[model samples]
Target chain A: MIKIKLLFAIFALATAFASSAAADMAIIVNPNNAVTKVSSDEVKRLYMGKTKSLDDGTRLIPIDYVDGSAIKQEFYDKVVGKPLDRIKVYWSRLTFSGHGRPPETLSDSARIKAWVAGNSDAIGYIDTTLLDGSVRAVLIVK
Target chain B: MSRWRLPLLLSTALVGGGATAAELKWDGFFTSTYSITNTKSTYRDIVHDDGSFDDSRFGLHVVSDIHPLWRLEAQLFAAGYEDNYATRLDWGFASFHLSERLNLKFGKLKYPNNLVSEYYDVGLAYPWIRPPHEYYSLEEPSASITYESFSGASAIINRRSGDWDLVAQPFFGEVELAESDANISKFIGIKLSASNDLTELQASVAQGRINAEGHELDDQTKRIASLGMHTEWGSLVNYLEYAVTTFSDSEEARTKAGYITLGYHFGHTMPHITYAGFDQESGWGQQSVTVGVKQMLNPSTALKLEMQRITPQLNPEAGAEMASGLFMDVPEKTRVNAFSIAIDVVF
Candidate 1:
C-alpha cells in the first residue's frame, strides 16, 4: 500500500509541473534578429524603459499588451517581477519626469506577433501556446 | 517672427502632416487631500484645526518627439495651495538625445536635488500623500533647503553594468521662489544614482547663492548634500534619506535633516510608518512620527489615511531667538497631532 501511494504522489507532482510549464509565456523577437536568448533582468529593463538598446547596440522597440489582459498580467508577474499597480506607479514616475516613455501597447497576442514579425526591432511577449514560426521566443516566463 | 508664431507654425505643420509628425502623448495625475491638525498654530500654510484642502492638485504632462533626436515636453500644473488655483507651466524642456548613453536638456526643468524631487508633486508616484517635511521643505520656513524648478540646462549620462543601472546628471540653473520672493542664483549640482530591480541609491551635492529681499538669508552662499536609498524585499519596502545644508558665512545657519520609512504590502493594501527629524544650528528643530495606510482602489488610483505626531524642540545653547520650529504662533514646547485623508489618481 505504501509503494502504491508513493507512486501516485509522484504522478500528481509530474502532472502539476506539466500544466505549469504549459501555461508559460514566451518573450518573442523577430526571427531574423541576431539575438537568440534574453535574461529575465534584460526583459524587465526593456519593458520598464530603462534601456533602449540591446547589448549589441541594436535599438529595441518593446511592445506591451493592453492593460487588464491576462497575458500582460502574467508577463508582468513572471518577467517584470512587479505588480500591476506598482508598475503603473513606476511608469508614472518615468513618464511625468520626461525620463522615458512606456512601450506602445497592442490589443492581443496575434497583433503582437504580427508586429514583431514585420519589425526586426520589435520585441513582445505571448502565450507559449500561441507560438508560431513567424516570431522567435527569446525567453520563457514561468 | 513673433515668439508665438514659430510654435504656431510648427503646430500647424505637425497637424497637417499626419504621417510625418511623431505622435504626441498626454498624461495626467490628480490628488485631493483633506487634513487637519489639533493645534491652534497653522502648519505649512494649510493644516489647522478646521481642516483644509490645500494639498489638492492637478497636473497634465505632454511629450512629443518632434524630430528623431529631439523631444519636447511640458507640464501644466495647478495646486490649491497656490493663489486661486492658477495654472502654471511647471516644466517646459527640450531634450537632445545626443547618443545612446548621453542626453542634454534645456529650459525650465524639475530640480533634481533629492530622491523624489522630480516627481514630488505627482502624489501617485510616491506612497506618501506628502513627502516628509523634515528633508523636503524650504529652509527659511522649515529646516531644509529644496527648490521646485529651475531655468537652465542639464546633461544626463546612463551606464549599465550587469544588473545595475547607473545615471549621472550634472545641472546648472537659477530658481525663483514664488512664495518668498527669494532667488537661487549660480546653482550647480550633480546627482549620481544606481538602481536594480529591488534597490536604488542616490547621492547629490549642490552650491548656490540665496538672495531674498528683506530677509536675513540675503546673499548667502549655500551648499547642500544629500543621500537617499530605497529598497524592496518581497512585500517589504523601505526608504531612507539624509540631507545637510551649510552657509559659507554663517555657521549658525547650518541644518541637517533626515527621514526613514518602512512599509509592508498586504495584497492591495500597504501599511507604513515614518520617523523624520531636523536640527538647525540656531536651535530650531522638530521630530515627527507618521503612521499611514494606503489602499489601492485600482491600478491607477490610491486612497491613503495618515496620522502624524509632531514635537517641537529648541536648543538653549543656540539661543532663545530661534524658538519656533516649522510653525507660526505656537508655544515653545507643544506637541501637535494631525490627521489626513487623500486620494491620488493617474491616467
Candidate 2:
C-alpha cells in the first residue's frame, strides 16, 4: 500500500511538471516573414518594448495570452527573465511614460495562432502541440 | 523649409486621423500619503499634525499615436486629497521618431536627471511613498532644488549595444518658477544614461540664466548637475544619487546633496532604509533617515508605511545668513520626526 501511495505521489508531481514544460513553447511568426530564427536577447527586447522594430527595420506587433496560464508564466520567466507581476509593473511604467504599450492580449492559443497567421508583422508564442503550417515557430527556448 | 515642419506635422496628424486609423491610449496613477511631523513650527511644504495629504497626487497620462513616426503625449496631474484638488498640465509634448533609435520632442517635458527624477510624481513606479528629499525635491520658493521639468526642444537617442543599453538626450529649454515669480531662460543640458539588465546609471549637467523677483532674490545664474545609479540583485535593491546646484547671483549659493537607499524584498513585502541630506554653502545643512515597508496589494496597487527622523543643522559661525531648500520658510529652526502611510495605484 505504501509503494502504491509513493507511485501516486510521483505521478502527480510529473503531471504538474508536464503542464508547464518550457520545451512545449515555440516563438511563432507569420510564415510570410523572412526572419528565420530570433535570439533570446532579441525576444526579450521585443517583448519588453525596447526595440520597436526588428533588426532588419521591420515593425513588430507582439501578442500575449490573456489567461493566467502556466504557459504565460513560463514565457515571462524563461524569456523575459522576470515574474508575471514584475512584468506588469514594467509595462505600467512604460505606458505611464508614453513610451510603449503592453502586447495585445488574446484569450487563448488558438486565437494567438489565428492572429499571428493573419498579420505579417505579428509575433506570438504557443504550445508546440498547436504548431502547424499556419504559423512558423521562429525560436524554441524550452 | 525647416520651419514648415511643425505645421506640416499638424496637418498630417489631422488629415491622417480622418484617413487612416489613429490610436489614443491613456494610463493613470494615484497616490495618497498621510504624514505628520513632530516640530511645533509649520514648515512651508510639510504636513504637520492633520493628514494634509500635501504630497498625495493623481496623474492621468495620455499618448496619441497619430502616425508610425509621430506621437503626442500629455499628463494631467492633481495634488492633495481634498475634493477640490487643483490640476496642472505637468507634461504636454509631441515626439517625432526619426528612426528606431532617434527621436525629437517639443513642449514641456520632465527634465530627466536620474532614475526617479522624471517619474518622481508617479508613485506606482517606485518603492517609496516619496522619493528622497535630498535629490529630487521641489525647487522653488528658495526651497526645493530639483527643478522637476522644463519647456523646449530635446533630442532623444536610444541604442542597444551588446550588453549595455545607451540612452543620450540633449535638451535646451526654459523653466518658469511660479513660487518666486521667475523664469529661467537659455537652459541647455546634455544627459547620458546607460543600463544593463541588473544596473542603470545617469549623469547630467545644465546651466540656465534665471530672472526672479521675490523675497530678496532675483537675477541669478543657475548651474545644476547630478549623477545617479540603481542596482538590483534578486530581491535586494539599492539606489544612490548625488546632485549639486549653484547660483552666481545669490548669497545662499552652492548646494550639495546626496542620498542612498538599501532595501531587501521578501515576496510582496520590501523593508528598506534610506539616508538623505543636503549642505548649502550658506552654512545650513539638513539630513534625515527613513525606514519603510512597501507591500504590493496587487499588480496595480501598493501600500507603503514609513517613518523618518529629520535633523537640521544651522551654523552661525560659518558667516552665512540664509538656508536653502527645505530649510527655507520655516517658522523656527527645529528637529522633527514624521511618519506616513501611502497607497499607490496604477490603472
lDDT per residue, candidate 2, A42-106, as tens digits? 88888888887777777778999873766888899899777776677677766766566787789
* lDDT of the candidates, in the order given: 0.83, 0.75
Local error of candidate 1 at B169, Å?
0.8
lDDT per residue (tens digit) for residues B164-231 in model 1: 98999999989877666678899899999999889999999888888887866689878888899998
lDDT of 1 at B225: 87
Off by over 4 Å in 1: A1-18, B1-19, B141-145, B179-181, B314-323, B331-333
Question: Candidate 2: what lDDT?
Answer: 0.75
True contacts kept of each: 0.74, 0.41
Summarize candidate 2's per-residue lDDT along B147-199 as a digit string, tens digits.
Answer: 54577889989988888889998989888753445777887888898988788
DockQ of 1: 0.73
Task: Score chain A of model 1 by TM-score against the reference chain A.
Answer: 0.86
